[model samples]
Target: MPHPTPSPREIFASGPLTGHVAVPGDKSISHRALMFSALAVGESRVEGLLEGEDVLATAAALRAMGAQIERGADGIWRINGVGVGGLLQPQGALEMGNSGTSTRLLMGLVASHAITAAFTGDASLTKRPMGRVIEPLSRMGAEFTAYPGGRLPLILRGINPAVPIDYTLPVASAQVKSAVLLAGLNTPGITRVIEPIATRDHSERMLRGFGATVTVEDDAAGKIIAITGEAELRPQRIVVPGDPSSAAFLVVAATIVPGSDIVVENVGLNPTRAGIFTALRMMGADITELNPREVGGEPVADLRVRHAHLRAIEVPAELAPSMIDEYPILFVAAAFAEGRTVARGAHELRVKESDRIAAMAAALGACGVRTEEYEDGLCVQGNGGGAIAGGGTVRTHLDHRIAMSMAIAALNARASITLDDASPIATSYPVFFQSLDLLRGETLVPAA
Candidate 1:
C-alpha cells in the first residue's frame, strides 16, 4: 500500500511576519457536512470543504454507504445523499483511518438502520476507547459486537425498529452526543441529550441549518438538547469557513516572537471553538478580530496579530472543552509569557492521540521553561515570549499538534529544537509548514 509523507522542515525566527493568508475549511465542520449530506435527501452542495485526510475519511465512508459525491470544476464539493433510513449495505468494512470523529459519529448513523457494518481504523484510532460512544448508542437500541477490550474491528448490528431514548451525557463529548442523536434520527420520538458542560455545537447548529428540528435549552441542571427523531433532513448548499485550529500556530507564532505581524483571513470564530483566542487576548496578545461574518451557519472572522509584551492569567477550567485541541499551541504561547499560566480540568488531554499533558511538560522543560506536570494538566512558567534556552529533540509521538507546537517553540530558543515524526501533521493541516515556509522565504536570504 502507498502512503503519504510530510517533508521535514526546520523553523527559525524570521523578520517580523507581515502578511495575510487564507486557512482551509474547518475540519470538524467539514466532517459533519459530508456525513449530514449523506443523511439529507437530494443533492447537497458544499463549498470550501477541507481536503485534509481526516475529513476525506468521512467522504469515503459516505461513498461506501451509497452516496454519490463529486468535485466540481469550480472546486466545490457536491454530494447526492442516500436519505435518512435509505442507506444500503456496503460491500466492505468502513476504513475510518485515523479519525475518531468519523468512527464514532458513523456508529450512530449505522445503529438505527437494518444493517450490519464492521468498523476498523489505523493503529492510533484503534487504540482509542470506543466505549464512550458505544454506551449511549447502546441505550438507543444499537447492538455492538467488539473485541473483549471494547476496541475496534467491531461489528455494529443495527436494530431497524430502534427505540428513541433520553440520554444525559456522562462527559462533555460532542462525538457521543452526536452518535446518539444520529441513531435517533431513524427512531420514533424525541431524542434528548443533556450535557453538563457544553462541547462544540456544530452538530446541533448544522442539524438545524439542514432543516432538522433541534431545540437547545439551558437551566440549573445543564444544557438539554432535544432532537425530533424519525424526521426528514432537507438538502441545502453549505459553505465551510476557515479553520481556527490551523490558524492557532500562526496566531501564536506571530504574537510571541517579536516583530511578527500577520493577517489570517476567513478563519472560523465560532464562540464554542474560539476560547483559545480569548485566553491569548487575556495574556495581552496584540490580536485583533476583523471582518466578522457568517458562513454555513457558523461565524467567520479575519485575525491580525502582532508581537506584544505578554503577561499570563490563570486559565479557567470551564474553557477547557472549547480549546482542548489547541492546548499544545497554548503551551507554546505560555512559554513566552511573563508570568506563570496554570491550566487545569484537562484530563481529556490524557486520552488524545498522545498523552498531551506529559508530552508538553517534558518538551517545554527540555527547552528551558519551568514546567510542573500534573495528572491532568500543566503549570508553565514564562520566558516573556522572547529568545529563551532552546536545545532539545522533542518527540511528537505521531501527534500533529505536538509537532507544530514544537516548531513554534523554535522561535524563542537559543539553538534549534528538533521534532520527531512530523509526518502526521498532514492529517489535518497539510499546508501548514509550507505556508510558514513561504512567509519565512519572503523575509530571508536565498539559500546557496
Candidate 2:
C-alpha cells in the first residue's frame, strides 16, 4: 500500500551499510509479463512480479478490461488472459496512478480492439506527455481525446482490424516502441518500426516468449523491427529477474560509503539495460558479478559491490538509452567521485515524472554539492569521497528516483538530510526504505 498523504523522511549519516539482499522484480518485465499474459488464451502464472503501486495499477486496469488477475496467498500472481482481440471496453476511466509505462503500453493494447476507455492518473502522471505513444496509436486507427498538450485524463476508442503503419521512432523511447508493437498484436498486416537508436528490448523478447512473430534486422539507420499481427499467444510461467535499476541504488550506496560491502542477488544483466554498471565500473567502483546465468530468457547475476575510491569519468552519451532511469542515482555517485563527471545526450530526463536534470541539480545544490545543468545532461563536481555539506530538505517533485537518490546521498553527508516527501518511493520500490534499513543494519526513525 502507498502512503495516501505526504511522508517526509530525514536520513542521518550512518556507519557502513552492509547486507545481502534482493531487490524487487524488474518493473519493465513485470509490466510486460502481466500484459502479455493477459493477451494469452489460458492461465499464466507470474512469480517475482513487483507488487508496487504502479504494477498494481496495471493489474487493476487489466481487470477492468476483462483479464482475471489475482494474487494467491503464496504470492504468485495468476492471470487469466482474454486473448488477442478479445479485450472488453473498460467500465470506467482507467486510473494509471503514476505509471507512464502502464498508461502508454496499455493504450497500444486497446488501439486494435473495438473498445473505448478513458485514461486518467495522479497529478504527477497527468503532467507527463502522452503524445509520443498517441502519435503511433493514432496512426494505427485509434482515436484519442486528451487534455491540452497530450496530457492524461484522456479518452481512446479502438478500431477493430486497425490499420498497421510502418513507423519510425522520432526519439529513442522504449515505451513508444512498445506501444506500437502491442498495437500490432491484433492488427491485420505486418507493422514495422524503424528505431534510429535502440532502447530496451524487453517487449520484443517477451513477445517472442509468448509465441509472437517479432523479427529484427540491423541496417544503417538502426534496427528495423517488424511484427506480424493477429498472432495467437500461449500462456507462460514467467520468473521476473531482479531490476538492475533498483539494484543501482544499493550498488551506489555500498560503493560510496566507506567500509561498506553488500550483495544484491538475482539482478537482471540484460545488455540493453546494464549500462549503469558499465558506467560505474568506468568510474572505478568495485562491482563483481557472481554466478551469472539466465532466467526467463534474460541474463541474471548476483552483484557484489564494495566501497572504493572512485574517480570521475565522462559517461558515454551512447549509454543513455540503456540506463535512462538510473541517471539520478548516477548523479549522486558522481558527487563523491574524485573529479568532475559529465553526462550528456539524456534530454529524456526532462519529461519524466519531473525534470530530473533540473531536479537533481537543484537538490544537489541544496546539499552543498556543485553541479552544472545542461539542456540534455548534467556535470557534477565530485568531492573525492569527503563528507558532503548536507542539512537541507530536498524537494522530490513526487518523483521516486529523486527521493531515493537523495536518501542515498545522506549516507556520506556531514549532516542529516530531509526529503520533502518520501511517499513517492512507493511507486516503484515499495520496500526501498526497508532495504536501506537492512543494508545499514539499523532501523530508520523518521522525524516527525
Candidate 3:
C-alpha cells in the first residue's frame, strides 16, 4: 500500500480555557524511579510513573540486567531489584529508542560495574553527541568506544573497581551530572561535582531518597554536589508528579485567548524545572498556585492559568539552563505577548531530541510570528496577546515540542495552523491531544 501524504493536524481554537488537567507522570522522575528501584535490595512500588517509551526503555534495560519489573492493571509498577552493584551482562546491545535520558542514565548504571554493555538508538539520538557523558565516565575509569566523536552505538567496558574523582560540569546539563553521580554508586570514596550553573535537581533529590549520601551546598560561584560511592540505596514507593513541560502547553493556550482560565493539576514545581512559569508570570500572565504539596521528594502544586494581556521581557542566559527544554513552547507564548522576548544561552538547544532553536524559529515564522533567530537563541515580537496569522504548515522535524508549539500557535491564530507529522508527540506526551480536548471543552473553544 502506498503511504499517505505526510501532514499534521490543523488545530483551530479560541478559548477561555478553564478546567483541571492531570498531566502525565514526570519523565525524569519515572526514569530515576525505575533505575533506582532496580538497584534496591527489595521490591519497590511506583505509582503515576510515566509509561512513555523513554522510561519503558530504562525498565526494559534493567529487566535485561536481571531485575524483575512488571506493570499491574492497577496502574502501578512492581520491581524486584538486584541490589546495588549486582548487575549481570546483558545478552545484546540495549537499544534505548530516542531517549537521551535513558541512554545516559543507563551509561552511569553500567559504568562502574564488572559488566560490559553496548547501546544504540534511533537516528536522531545516534547523531547527538555523547562526548559530554563519555568524558566524565572516562575520567572515572570507564572505557567507552563510540563512532568518531563519541556518538551512539557505543560500548562501555565497565571498571571492576572504578576510581571515583571530583568532576566539574563544563556545561549545565542535568543528564551529564546525573550520569556521573549514578556511576559513582558502585565506586569507593567520594565523587564530587561542581556545577557553575544549576540544572534540574530531580536526579539529586531522588538519589538521596534512595538512601545515597547526596549532598548539596550553595556558594558564591554555584552549587557543589557530592555523592558517596558504594553506598546502599533502599527503594521506596514513588508517586511521580505531573510534568511541568506538559503543563506549558495549557499555560500558553489560556494566555493567548482572552477570558480563559485553566487549572493544571499536580504539576511538578521543582525550582529548576519551573523557569518557564517564572518567565510567564514576569510577562504578566495571570497565574495562581493552589494547594502546594510534596510528592516523591519533589514539590507539587496546581496551576491556574487565566487569559491576560502579556508583555515580553528580556530573558537572561543564567536562566536558560533551568527552562532549556521549554523554549519552543515559550517561543509560542512570546508570539502573543506585547513587545520583544529575548532568550539567550540557548546553544544547548542545538543538541536536544532535535535542533529546537532552529525548529521553533522556523515553525513560528511560518505561523506569521515575527521571530529573529540568534546564534544561540531568538527574539520574538508579539502583538499584545492577539491572534496570530496562522495559514502556514509547520514542519515538526519529528519533535514533540515542535508539534505541540505549532499547535499552541494555532489556538488563537486567525487561520488554522497545520503541523506536519505530529505522531512523534507520543514519544513523550501520549495524551497531549486528549488533554487539549478536555481543556477545550471547559473553555468552550470552537475547533474543527
Candidate 4:
C-alpha cells in the first residue's frame, strides 16, 4: 500500500472542546487479536479492530503466513487460523511499515516454527534496536542474520521443536515480553519469562482467552509468566476496546483547554494501561469514569473529562510501563498546568518511534514552554493554565504521538501550531484531525 503524502497542517486556538467521541480500537489489542485468531483452529470474528496502518501490517504478515483474513460488510474482521506450529513460510520479505510492535511480535511468532522469513520496514523502524528481542529469541533456538546493532532487514530461520528457556527481561518492555510468550507457543514443554518490571499482559490474557494454558505468579523478581507450548487455541469473538493511548490526546486536550468538556466512550481502562489516567488525576484533572465494565477481558469505561485547574505533580517512575506511550501528551498537558511536572524513570522513551524525551523538549521549547530534558525523562514548567505561545513550528520527526500531542497544545495557544508533516499520524490514528474537528466544532484550515 502506498503511504500518505507529507501534509503540513496548522491547528489554531479554538473555543471549548465539547463532544462525545470515540477513538479507534486498541492498536495493541487489535494486533494481538489478529495474530491469535490466525493461530486458532477455526474461524474467529473481531469487532472494533483498529484499521490503522500499523495493525494492517500485522494482518498482512499473518495472511502471508497462511491465515485467511478478511473484513465483512458489517465492519467485523473474520479470520481462519492455521493452528499452532502450522504457519507456512512467506514467499518474500514481510514489509513491516512503521510498526515496531508488528515487527518484533511477529518475529516471535516465526521463531519456533519450521520456516525461514525475511523482515524489513521503513526508516524509523529500521533504526530501532531489535537486539532486545534477538537475545531471548536466540536463546529459544532461533537463528537470525541482522544488520549491525540488530537493525531490521534481517533474516530469521525458525527451529521446529525449538528449545524453550526461562528468560529474564533486562528492562521493562511489553513487546519483548509478548514476543517471548508468542515464540513459546510452538515450542515444546513450558516457556517462561521472568519480568523484573511488569509490562502489559495482553499476551497472557489473550492466550488464556483462546484456551491456551498461561499461568502468572508474582515473586521477588516481578511477574513470572509461563506458557505451555503446542497448545491448541480456540477461536474467539473479540471486541477491542478504544485505545487508551489514542484516548490520551483527547483527555489531555480536554483538561488543558479551558471550559472543554467531553466524553470519550468505551476506552480501555486496563490497570496495566491506565497509568496516563492515574497520572492526570494526580495532576487534578477533572475526569470521571462512567458505567465502568469489562469488555473482552479488559476493563472499559466512558471518561467524562471537563476542564479543571490542573496542578503539576511528580509522575512516578513505576507508572512508566503502563503509560509509556502517553508521556508525550502528558508533557503537553503539563505546559498548561500550574507548576512544574517532573517525569522520570522513562528511559524507554528514547527508543520509541522517536527519541520522545528530546523531541518533546524541542517541540515544547519551540512553543515557548520551559522544559529540561534528561536521558530518562523531562521536567516541564507549567504556565498556571494559561495559553502557550505557539508561533514556532514543531518538527514531528515522523512520530504520530508527537504530531498529535503538539496539535492538542495548539488548542490553548496564542498562535497556530505548525506540524512539519502530519502524514505519520495515519500510522496509528488516521482520523485524529477529524475527531479534533468534531470536538472543536470547526474545520481547521492548513497552515500558510
Identify the superior model by lDDT, candidate 2 or candidate 4: 2
- Taken over the whole model, the C-alpha lDDT of each candidate is 0.84, 0.95, 0.86, 0.94
TM-score of each: 0.95, 0.99, 0.95, 0.99
Worst 10 residues of 4 by lDDT: 1-10
Where in model 4 is the C-alpha error above 4 Å?
1-4
lDDT of 2 at 300: 100
Ranking by lDDT: 2, 4, 3, 1
Cα distance off (Å), candidate 3, residue 380: 0.6
Model 2 agreement with the true structure over 238-353: per-residue lDDT tens digits: 99999999999999999999999999999999999999999999999999999999999999999999999989999999999999999999999999999999999999999999
Clashes by residue pair, model 1: 16-259, 336-385
Question: What are the candidates' C-alpha RMSDs?
Answer: 2.3, 1.2, 2.7, 1.0
Model 3 misses residue 75 by how many Å? Answer: 0.2
Instruction: Report the error of model 1 at residue 171, Å.
Output: 1.1
Instruction: Enumerate residue pairs that collide in model 4.
Output: none
Clashes of each: 2, 0, 5, 0
Residue 127, candidate 1: Cα error in Å is: 1.9
